[model samples]
Target: MFSTGQLIFALFFILAFTVVLIVTYRKDKTIHKKNYKGFGWVGLGFTVFVIILFLIKHMLNK
Candidate 1:
């Protein structure tokens, strides 16, 4: 059986990965679309929500 610490650690690992992805994506400015700004921000918000939900589930399962 997995331990609580393991679940928490995994959650943190995923969160770190998400942060890295978001930062990398934001820094990428090669695209010239004057209409994607809103979509981009909404996508980032979705990523954060998913991370938070995953963390909550991990904690609750313990």
Candidate 2:
């Protein structure tokens, strides 16, 4: 079992880490929007490819 001090430290650490992470993401939000534009289509294509592969495997196994 964790000591009380250890649990308190973890709680504060998590809160500080989350705050820092949100601030960092907000600072870079505009840069990310420009850089990662059209990224969703690539993800969609990859997902479709995986689904096609799974379907082919299922059909062949039948």
Candidate 3:
């Protein structure tokens, strides 16, 4: 039930926000590559840990 003006403003805001986010990520890409090399491993480890916990809980419930 949004008015035409509100819809237009929302579209413009989303476009502007997306452009800013992309530009900021591009600018920071090099810094992130150098400083966060092991980040993927940490994420993977956490995911595995969560899966193990779920499996253990399911086994104990049975």
The digit string of per-residue lDDT tens for model 2 on 1-62 reads: 99999999999999999999999999999998999999899999999999999999999999
Per-residue alpha-carbon lDDT of candidate 3 for residues 1-62, written as tens digits (9 for 90 to 100): 99999999999999999999999999999999999999999999999999999999999999
Off by over 4 Å in 2: 43-62
Across residues 1-62, which tens digit of lDDT does each residue of candidate 1 receive?
Answer: 88999999999999999999988877765463554658878899999999999999999999
In model 1, the clashing pairs are: none
Best candidate, lDDT-wise?
3
TM per prediction? 0.45, 0.65, 0.68
- Looking at model 2, how many pairs of residues clash? 0
Clashes of 1: 0
lDDT of each: 0.87, 0.99, 1.00
For every candidate in turn, the CA RMSD to the true structure comes to 11.2, 3.7, 3.0
The better-scoring model by TM-score among 2 and 3 is 3
Would you list the rank order by TM-score, best first? Answer: 3, 2, 1
